[model samples]
Target: LRSTTVRNLDGVFELMAQATKGTRDAAAEEGAHVLAEMSPKLGSAVERQIGRLEADVEHLLDEVFDAQIFEGVAALKSHDNYTFEHSVDVAFYGVMLGRKLALGNEYLKDLALGCLLHDIGKMYVDERVLNKPGKLTASEFRQVMRHTVLGFQLVRQMPINSPRPAHVALQHHEQQGGGGYPNHLTGTNLLARTPRERFDTSRMMLLSELTAVADVCSALSSDRPHRAALPATEVLTVLRQMAGGHLNRQAVEAFVSMVEVFPVGVHVRFNGGKYAGSYGVVVKCTPGAANRPVVRLLFDAQGAPVPEGVEIDLRKLPDDGELTAVPEEGVSVEEYAHRLAIARH
Candidate 1:
């Protein structure tokens, strides 16, 4: 199975090299194509194939500078495309956060490449273990964890211009204070000759730390083999809880401040108040206040269409008025029609 998977991936890589054009979306799409072809395989074939993406990856970064982080949560839950889509989401998040931190252009490009291919090593793990519907046994879990080292080794062998990007694949799983996998690296460990230096954030490479933040956000917002995607609000709460211990405190805070927890395009329902039972789609979001956005009311409290849409700015609503995410199952046919009505607006 592994050999077959590797052979298929090699063919896919050759196709990607031929199909990838200079456009950023093309590069991104071709890269995703390669990712979708991955399975439990490892070796020079994987390494060489990844090298084929270098030009496209660099070209993709140039285009990413003006791109917004797309909110494609509904699209991402499709079981077959989850891995590829998740990688794209991570790249979007990492590059944007890199911009937020004022990283130089070169650094941003490296961050983008690293985040996009960070999980390539997962291709080396068996599909059974990777997609098991229940909790992994200890041995299966260890196989999953080994992807970090496998990814690091695979990336190191590639012809990528910079070595720093490889480290993002290697260390994004490492924690701040202590307990993490593969290597128990800390944020400030190298400079911690004295105890005081341990508290500083400079020891770990900034790109790695930033990618970690992006990686976590993307993972929480995505569906996995074992679980459904968490609502964006719950994802934010989990991110906050992990800060300072499991994640870099400063990076987490910066990410949270910039990302819209309740991003546009999601259908939401009023949790309580006069508007309770009303349905709407988020139309706009403010950076600093992610939980609240401008919603376009589509359905009334009685579950009937509003006829003519009405806009409400959630930030201006009373404290008791709250918007809750509507599950995929909760979207009605009428709501879907309204959602389609303004999709391009």
Candidate 2:
């Protein structure tokens, strides 16, 4: 007989808080059951592959290589599953960039190890706090942000030598604007440098940037705490825009190249044309015409389509007609899913 007035995210929190203790317990239990009930077999093969890399490389293997990581990332269609897998991927990539930036061998391993467990801090955080759909309240955000220092402190308890991992954990959120928390010192504070300069990015900066890119890319490219997966091309667009005085430009470029902006079998919209999967191994990636790289559009996620497969070899076209555009509309993995369902029928 009563209508509830709901306004901001607070209402949701209030509702959650008001939930009967048993009710909340049951829900959490069920959530855990569902998570356990579902076999994470989809990512099993990918995880196995990563595990096969050198012991030190188990973390950085995918981060350094975009294609392999995305392949694993794309396997996750839900936020929970994606977050579980993507963090590892980001850590791996961060270590890769740290190594490329010529961080010493010890730092390289420590950085890799640090990244491997940077978000391990989150384990101390509540899932509800971590996965809140809307913006977090200041207190809640502080609670969440505390994971950085908390993670560092926690890892230190594990008897790890070489403090780089804990520092990486601590600095991952420390930004260039000197705006990051848990130690908000700006210039000369935690790799703070001129915004957007490639060289401006220090070793920790590179690790953080690489981690951020990998984190967001994996987040957007797959799914997240609040939303479905974003298209890889659109994700890249967002990353480019996000680089405005925040992340390193050339570093991002290096990352894009590492990941093959247009991986094989990804449907893309070329300039003046329709949709098709990745044309071929990325031949070149320029800020201009980044999407359409003279791809040989394949029918499936694999090389070429079979049976009634259609492959458009853009290599045949002259330079003037080279592929040069990205998709205008938001491409949904859902649409692809629907198509697959139809094909199955």
Give the number of the best model, judged by TM-score.
1
Q: For model 2, how does the per-residue alpha-carbon lDDT over 153-241 read when each residue is reduced to its tens digit?
A: 54453435556566667767765455665675233223334556435434344455556555656667665556777655566777777
Q: How would you encode candidate 1's per-residue C-alpha lDDT over 1-345 as one tens digit per residue?
A: 223323434453344333322322332323333333333244555456565455445555554554453222222221324556566667767877777777788888788778876786676567788889898999888777776765665565455678877778887888887677667777742211366553444455677778888888777766777787776667778888988887888887777776665667777889887788888888888766667789888777866666455788877875747678886567664665775566545
lDDT values for all models: 0.66, 0.48
lDDT of 2 at 248: 56
Pairs clashing in candidate 1? none
Question: Looking at model 2, which ten-residue stretch has the lowest summed lDDT?
Answer: 1-10
Alpha-carbon RMSD of each model: 10.5, 14.4
- Candidate 2: give the clashing pairs: 59-92, 60-92, 63-93, 178-186, 266-278, 279-296, 279-297
TM-score of each: 0.65, 0.56
- Per-residue error for 276 in candidate 2, Å, reads 14
Scored against the true structure, residue 84 in model 1 reaches a CA lDDT of 62
